[model samples]
Target: MSTALTFTTSRRPDGAVVLTATGEVDMSNAGAFATALAGARQTAADTPFVVDLTAVEYLDSAGLSVLFPHVEHLHLIANPLLAPVLTIAGLDDVTTISE
Candidate 1:
């Protein structure tokens, strides 16, 4: 079964956008995740776009794919459990990951 995923968007005083995700991220909810990312980008086009995955319990390839396109401008905050997955996907080399 697909796990539930929740997304919240917030803007920092400096105009940076933060997209916080909770729960698992898999193919089932990847589209929603992408949509959230797109919205966050549109909200703050020139500033930092942070994806906080600290509360996420899981993330699959589909979710990773959505993140790839935004690597140039995305900053991620993940828990230790998800760190290796992101690193193995080579996301760490492109974007900042704070665990």
Candidate 2:
């Protein structure tokens, strides 16, 4: 079953698109996460896509997989707990990560 994962998309004053995620993100809800990212990419393909995971309680490999294809166009604002996972997955090499 899917957990309670919510995504909110907004644009920054600087024109960057940000998608904020809350709650747990696992295999069950990873597709939803991908859909949100796809929508944000469609809205502004040329601009940077920032994902804010500060409010997310948990994230699994499935959640990370959804981000792989967009790494080149993505930036991440994650909490300390998730930062290391991102780094270990080598996402930090392709995308900018902020704690």
Candidate 3:
């Protein structure tokens, strides 16, 4: 069965775009997460794109792959559980991640 995932985008007063994701991020719903990320990027290409993952209960390789290409432009805010995963995946080295 597919996992539940939802994305919400909001513009900050400073003009940055924040994409808040909730629920699990696994192979089952990674495609939708990628689509949301792409859409958020398209919404404000010039501004910073913040992806909030504090509410995400889990994330796997599929979700990490989807985030790889966007590292140059992504500022990730993740919870303690996912911070290590992102770091282990080498995403933290190339991108800014706050835990």
| lDDT by candidate, in order shown | 0.91, 0.91, 0.94
Judged by whole-model lDDT over C-alpha atoms, candidate 1 comes out at 0.91
lDDT of model 3 at position 57: 92
Query: What is the per-residue lDDT of model 3 for residues 1-99, given as tens digits with 9 covering 90 to 100?
Result: 899999999988888999999999999999999999999888978666999999999999999999998888889999999999999999989999998
Model 1, 55-88: lDDT tens digits are: 9999999999999988988899999999999999
| TM-score for each predicted model, relative to the true structure | 0.93, 0.96, 0.96
Q: Report residue 37 deviation for candidate 1 (angstroms).
A: 0.7
lDDT at 70, model 2: 90
lDDT at 93, model 1: 96
lDDT of 2 at 37: 89
Candidate 1 residue spans exceeding 4 A from truth: none
